[model samples]
Target: MEDSIRRFFARYEQFFLRALAGEPDPAEVAGLYAEEFIAASPAGVKAGKNDASLIEAMRQGHAQYRAIGTRDMRVRGLRLSPIDEMHCVAHVAWRATYLRADLPETVIDFEVHYLMQQRQDGPRVFGWISGDETAVLRRHGVL
Candidate 1:
């Protein structure tokens, strides 16, 4: 059971990284999220009642911040906690080096508590409660 869950999350992480890097492939992002997908970030919240809305929002988000490209993306770790039989909580950390046309490379490290629920269709992602420790890629030298 653990192995299956791990595989699912690993695949999802890869898809997310590709989307964040502006892959422009809707299926890459859409495949990971369930029919009722919800995402919460520091800036805003988006809920997808169906696959179409989720993909559209992802495209818009990438378009809005399309200037930056994500590099060195990795999943630091994942620990599944018991929320219930159907839902699990995952403590995860990730880091990305960002490059923008206007600004030089900057690295941001983020840790998020992901509350994940496995549904018959797929994973309904939510409960991203917090993130921390963002720093600039100083060695790269911002322009």
Candidate 2:
């Protein structure tokens, strides 16, 4: 189970790197989450579906990141707890690095919790909880 968790996160890292690039493959990014999922953040909880709207949202998100000079994102660490045979929770530590034309690189560290479903196809992120990302980004001058 631990090995499986590591493998899952490793794949997620690859997916993120590809999916959040300047020219992302939406289909490949969509594969990271379930068809229907929930996102909980400082703003609120929202039920979302993997559709064209979601794809466009992802694209816009990447655009924002690019605008902020974000060059890469990384999973710093992960802790997993099994909810059941077919479900689990993951606490993930993340870091995003940005570059500037006249300043040094900036790195921001944050954490997120994910509710995952273990399917025959693989692990799927059905829901995730996040902190006040906007404030953090703004404080870091990356917003």
On TM-score, the leading prediction is 2
TM-score (C-alpha) between model 1 and the true structure: 0.69
TM-score for predicted model 2 compared with the true structure: 0.91
Best by lDDT: 2
lDDT (CA) for every model shown? 0.63, 0.84
Model 1 Cα shift for residue 133 (angstroms): 10
Give the Å error, residue 61, model 1: 2.0
Q: Candidate 1 regions off by >4 Å?
A: 41-46, 101-104, 120-122, 132-143
lDDT over C-alpha atoms for residue 26 of model 1: 81
User: Model 1 over residues 1-143: C-alpha lDDT tens digits?
Assistant: 34556777787677666666667678766556555655576656756565677679778866654444555467777788877877887777766676767666776666777777777655656545663222243444431
User: Model 1: which ten-residue window has the lowest total lDDT?
Assistant: 131-140
Tens digits of per-residue lDDT, candidate 2, 1-143, equal 55676788888777667755765887876777889999999899999998898889988888887777888889999999899998888999999988879546999999999998888878888999999999998898766
Worst ten-residue run, lDDT, model 2? 14-23
